[model samples]
Target: MGTSLNIDLTAPGARQLPKRTHVQYAALCFRIREGKVKVLLITSRGRQRWTLPKGWPMAGLSPARAAAREAWEEAGVRGEVLETCVGGFTYTKRTSPHPHMALVYQLEVVSQEKKFPERGERKQRWVSPKRAAELVEHPQLARLLREFHPHLRKH
Candidate 1:
């Protein structure tokens, strides 16, 4: 038999490739104010790239509830989440521990916290959906935001 080579994934020095696609909740946090539609975006923890608020499924909450929780944790948003998911988009994976598939939920933010979870690690922004589409790196998410304008209902 030929000599075999092996590397330990659990080793501290070994680099880990992204695992299989993970199903996660994405908060399509948005609001209508002053006759305009605004979407919220938050920066990633380490790389600081702009992204939507999202996380793994919470213990007992429904998907939309979990998405709302993510919004509050990542963006300090408190709001009503529409049960019907507007759309979903595959996460464009980069160098990550786990590649993810995100189900996007629309949230109508009613209040925002001045101090909340992840405040120090992230920065939140409210901008026009068009502007959000321009800033986000994920292609499907960007397109979702771009085409979102027509769905706006006067609030």
Candidate 2:
């Protein structure tokens, strides 16, 4: 988590203020097994809310690259970034003081490692799409899970 302060740099008495840019990057990894679709979700260490493994994009890394790193760090999964993006959803930042938008990407899990190095304090779970929708705190993520259900069933 990070913090940013909102400073209004007005010349004198400006009626309208310029909008500040706040960008956040995130990724979602979905794994399908058998007839059920399972997504790797991590419970936040502080809030204890279940969410997709995501974070700010790292320097010199593309969104997809950052996503793969995040998935490995948070969920102990090694996945492939499909040529096509499954979908994306936006949500306001609840953890940050500043009002920021979080961009979520859908990634497919190709493989998984046995251990997670960074998220020792947090709990990771592979949940069914239906169960995921109910467990995630964000409605948009829940909708994403729903959208993935039909496609996952086919695989």
Per-residue CA lDDT of model 1 for 9-123, tens digit only, reads 5999796546676878888888888989889999998788888999889898998899999999888999888666666667655666666778877888989988987889998
What local lDDT does model 1 show for residue 112? 94
Error of 1 at 82 (Å): 0.7
Q: In model 1, what is the error at residue 83, expressed in angstroms?
A: 1.1
The model with the greatest TM-score is 1
Per-prediction count of colliding residue pairs? 0, 0
TM-score of 1: 0.80
In angstroms, the error of model 1 at 98 is: 4.6
- Per lDDT, the best of the predicted structures is 1
